[model samples]
Target: MAPPLLIFLIMIHGVCSQKENVIYSPSHICALKDSSVIMNCTYTYPTGHQITKVFWTKGPVKGVEPPDLSEDPEYSQRLQYLGDKQQNCTIRLSHVTLKDSHEYYFRFITDKPDVKWTGIPGVTLNVTDLQVESPERVTEGDSVRLTCKSSCTLTDRATFIWYRNSQPLTERRDRNNELLLQSVRREDAGRYSCAVHGHNHISPAVQLNVTYSPRNVSVLITGSGEIVSGDSVTLICSSDSNPPALNFSWFKGGTFVGSGRIYSISKISSDDSGEYKCRSINEHGEKYSDAVTLNIMYPPRNVSVSIIRSCQIWAGGSVTLICSSDSNPPALNFSWFKENESSAVGSGQSFSALQSGRFYCQAHNQHGSQRSDAVTVTVKGHLVILYISIGVVCGAAVIFMMLVWRIRRMKKRNDTHESQMVDSRPPHDRHKACDVELSDPVYENVTADQLDDCKSELDSSVYENLPHNNKRL
Candidate 1:
């Protein structure tokens, strides 16, 4: 007996001195449907402690477990024994689903701890239902709120997060473990989901469906409220929508006027005047705006012509003729025309009248056309009259010169005639003129000196009669 006691004590001491074999694996797993998953667990004991039995068991409904070798009927087929007698205690599960998801308890029986068991921490398996929800719609300038609820019961304090079209939103506390939004905008409208984290597991997401009416619907005018004939005008309709989808239509005088986002009047006329309205439609509903009136005024009103200057203008004098009218958008074209001419003068509102004529102006716009009351431009002919008067004065001056020359010639002739008359009278006084002469005339020599003169004359006469005349007498 003493020898047997010593052997037992040695055996116990040896057993206690040997190190235990230990194994460890993951105690929790998360997977998706139709996917594979691994459950990790390990055990510890002496080197010769062969792993006799290794199997997984699901939790009993609420709480009961049998202590004997009889297997629980519910986990018979799904349970897998992964560890062999020597090593490897991890398990792998295939074709996972929500129904197969639960807490699994790993039980291992070793040869050294006969009839006893080594169990690791139970692992909770989570099978997620990953799916996307349909997108939502929201109008411009309106407010919306979306909520994402979880399909699982999250008892532990969990963090809830939201996503828009796959982008993560700010995390939220787990009061209800739901994603929430306040005053959502058009840009916030899109695919949304919620993620819940609790009990070291994530719950499946819940989708939020949001729909709203169109907002900020408005109509814009390209021009003023008053339009004219032959003028171009544009009316634009705009609004905000979810999915960026919208239909725009225009109406005039309670009747459908045009299609598309903009309604254009190529040639606006007086007949185009009426009340205009715009309507925006979406999947949510339709919205109509208040009507705006379009009063097409006469092309131009009160067309009149004004003469800027009327002084005695020279041939090159500049005179301005102004054509004026009242119209919206100003008159595009202003032209001056002679009463019966085929061409237009001056391409603008005012024209310089260089030539003399009767001129009129025309003011035109898209609404209509107007002709100014005819204006008569009487270019003064004073210059021509002045030229004529200067010619007449020059002709008068030439006639006066000719008359004075004729009078001077007559005066010279009269003086010559008077001198000849005086000469004819001088003949009676010719004897007196001879007495005054310095020399005697030949007829005055007959007065002799005495009778001797006569005797001598006789003797001379006798001598003269004889050939030589006797000088001796």
Candidate 2:
């Protein structure tokens, strides 16, 4: 037992005389305000003594006998020791502040009253309250810089890490503390933060606002393609930007029409047809939208009523009155009007001419209506024409009668000439010629009394020339 004690004593004495090595990665840390932090530490001691206690010390009253974090008023509920006395000594502090920034050391005690050690050159905690230093507003295409700041100067050199919208950004190693934006745009806007490289605890995110001019501007219109005169319409202006647009303006062709994000026309007209655009303005800059076209339709114009073929119409005769007009929707409804009449005389594209005088027409549609200029419609007289027509017909009848008489006389003369030619021809020899007569049987039909009267007029030479059988009769 005495030899064992001696050996133990020698080992203890050797371990006590040797210095312990303290290992703590990232000697310097940049922590954000009101964020959780971890101080990681581990140590080695000679192989003989039982460890009793381990604790941390930092901040305002740091050098003398320091207070235990477990008992401190500010850190009692928000601090946790995650390590044991053997070799590991790490702690977690929640909701850290600028006051937490200081030099920190880890000290350990053993069973022997005299065997106590504190690791010098311990982990250096640099609680840097990161702040984004940048201009409040900036215009698009403008160059800008954002700086990351710390509450206290750190003894150890550190590399800065930048985050946007809680996500880490890619940048060259040379740009560690500041972020340079060559041309600020609407996409380059979000919350920003900074932290030290190789440190898990980051600074409280400070918002980085990149102001920019309006872009991708356009005008939104709501109206029908058949937007007629007197119809209502609305126009909206839109743009992409950082922050809100300050003002809006509207233009029609070269004329300044109105202002505001929404432009309204209570009653549109034909004059409203033109090229239109919108202008957007902000603290950053101004931008214009692409041009759009606005068209206002109307019912009809230049309506008129005219007589088909001729303006003159005979009494008791018929004529067509045609209505015409120029209209956008092609004048679906038409009406004919007479002078000095309130109501329409007829309702159609054409009307039959009755008692004609002065007439007009109206063309109408859903949009509006138009009336035509009056035109005179006169009824022609037909008394002289009727008389001339009767006289001409009588003359033609007389001429036709005379032509008939002449034709009859010519036919009679031809018959008489044929008869004379037969009688005057030299008689053929009696022996060779046979007599032939073609006539009505007047003698045969006569009674005795008629025969006696006709007997005196009869020619006896006709009987004398008869054949021998009738010679004496």
Candidate 3:
């Protein structure tokens, strides 16, 4: 309802006073690390006002002149102005880092004194680096997931690539940021990292630990193949596990013998010869190793000769004697010998004694040899009986001759004594005493010479008395 002239005047005044001094563009930007970003902007001002200075400043404070980004040491080399000072205020920030993230404002100064302007609610830049999030530990055979994280969502559509132990996983690529592992195994444990495809930035690595039970358990013997008795031996238990097995148990056959990573037998004996195994244990589980035989070589022992008695085995004046011994890798070679002979008379485990004598057997093995105690073998035959009879007759004859010689020597000594005494009444007395002495025998100690002379006389008398064919006996 106002007048036309007043309305025209108000319109002219409004048109003259109206000034659009503002910036138009996106107010927020999300950028990748070490990459370039563009800030599209435009500005306006009242007519007849020329821009004297134009620059970009970050984190502007109220009533304070914001520091120009182009002059800043951190951004000077990377900042570039791409638009004119009048309208376009676009800018490019190259090689942006996390430290470059801040609110930025486009500022301009007019030629007139006290005339300056700054865009309010300016562009907010957010620079982000990749990071990986994973579990600290995972049991084997369990599914696992890892995520690639950033402070802000990336502006570009990205495909994630995974890596383990610094090696790229060529088969694992997905549009999502998560890496899924199905029924994970121990081999999958390592330093894990993630990256966006077509981007140079990669996340820092994180360690992934996988736990499992023992596997490939085995026992190793530290020595040569020839394990002789009295030699020291060691058995080592080894296995593969997520965490190294700290407990180990040793078994001899089915009996538990010891517990340790290394089992040592000092001065091992024959009793130690058997199958040995080891068990490797950890928190996860345990596993047993394959059994290994400890063949302890030793010398022959407990050697003995036994006479085999059998009704049908006795043959032709000979008896079978068997030699037995105890040894590892049983003694195969045996030698038979007489009691007093230095050389072996026969060879083998058994021996036949044709003649009566004391016999023994020697058992031989790689380690050493041993001989058995001597055993007496007696043979019964016609020749043996005849020899026994001869021996008896000869022994009796020698004793009878010795008695007669002693009696005669005593009679001679009595005769000499009677002759030496002057026989006055002595002859009749001596003759009477001699007859009494002959009836009762006188005893005395005989010298070696006397015994020798008696033996000589007895031999002659026995030979003459025996039959001519048996004289040699």
Candidate 4:
């Protein structure tokens, strides 16, 4: 019985000598910058026990004794008594800079004589500079990558935040901490930075130098073909770049010609014809475009003016005043000027003006421009009057001939009618004498003398022929 009782007493003594309970508010060491930071700890003791005193201390440095809350005068101003004997314990450091970086330990006591607790190898605080990384230049329609690396070894888990042009970006984990810009455009070309949030500490800014050249460069001419002298011509150069173009220059015949995107030649001439080039430059690099050539041909010549007539155009008849000029490569423009007003005409060799007056034409080609000598067109109004008079005279002659033909026809009809009338009239008494006349003539007045003559003639003949005819039986 005595041996058993002695063994129980030793067991009770072993239980009473066990260590007190303690737990830190924040189990991990936190980092901070030149700003505020919070540290906390919590613990649980036997139910009957109550807290009496509580304090905080710094871990032992080198071989020196750990800081004591009751005796240390140097830490008094900086130290805080945040622990509640009955509830919780936490510490806050304000205006914390690099110098405040150190391990913090806590100590506590309870009203029950057997209960006591102390912090179990507590946390360490580190203050560091903010992190900053920025890109210098970015081009339009390009993807950009920026990386933000920790200057110091970031032992704890940290969050990285990215920014572009001072605007906040999405936060991400420390690993794979690069900001990726998908299909970056000109608007994305600006300063970029990253912020590291770990243990409540932010790092300093870091700059990234990025560069790219112009893209999609193009050249355009306002008008194609040969540019005439004394005519303004424009050549336009365009490109896609960030921060806009720094400089634009034009070259002709391998020599710098102008200082703007649109190079204008106030008076284009044959001398202006050459291989023209344009170059655009930015902070990134220089870009050159393909060259174009201008061809200047011969000036206009053989300027002649005339009037166009249709049929027998009399005075007051409308006619066209024509001016023509010959030029190589054809004329680019033809203008008709009347009075003080000028209007552009067709590009053909001739131009016409309907309203005749003092008029002329000017022709232009790539080489030069020419103006014809002015001519005055005199329109005769009396010719129309003469034509009308001649027409009237000819019409009268035709009418006179027609009247004579009608009169002759009427006379012939009248003569035919009279002849018919005379033929139709009855024959008179001449016809009655025919039968009686024949009866009266039969009674002879053949008288005696005629008989005597007949006898005598017969007698002579008888005497002569007496012998011949004796018998007259």
Scored against the true structure, residue 364 in model 1 reaches a CA lDDT of: 92
lDDT of 4 by residue, 1-473 (tens): 34777755544332212334455545555454545566776655667766677777776566664556435655456556566775567766666666666777666677876565555566667756555544555555567677766434444555677766666765434455577777776555556666665334444444443445777777788886656656788889998765468699988867887887888777776667789888999877788888887775568887766777764355444556666777667776777666465565434545444444677777777766788887775556676688788889999999967865765565466447645654565533222221222124331222222223224334454434333222221
Candidate 2, TM-score vs. the true structure?
Answer: 0.56
List ranges where model 4 is wrong by over 4 Å: 1-28, 34-79, 84-90, 105-122, 128-161, 170-178, 183-186, 195-238, 242-305, 309-389, 419-473
**lDDT for each residue of candidate 2 in 388-451, tens digit (9 for 90 to 100):** 6878999999996785576556546644664565566664522122133212232222223322
lDDT of 3 at 94: 94
lDDT of each: 0.60, 0.71, 0.82, 0.61
Number of the top candidate by TM-score?
Answer: 3
Worst 10 residues of 4 by lDDT: 429-438
Off by over 4 Å in 2: 1-66, 70-98, 105-123, 129-139, 142-184, 194-275, 278-304, 307-319, 325-330, 337-345, 358-362, 367-376, 383-473
For this target, which candidate reaches the highest lDDT against the unseen true structure? 3
| TM-score per candidate, chains pooled | 0.42, 0.56, 0.69, 0.48
Note the clash tally of each candidate.
14, 2, 0, 15
Model 1 residue 153 CA deviation in Å: 4.9
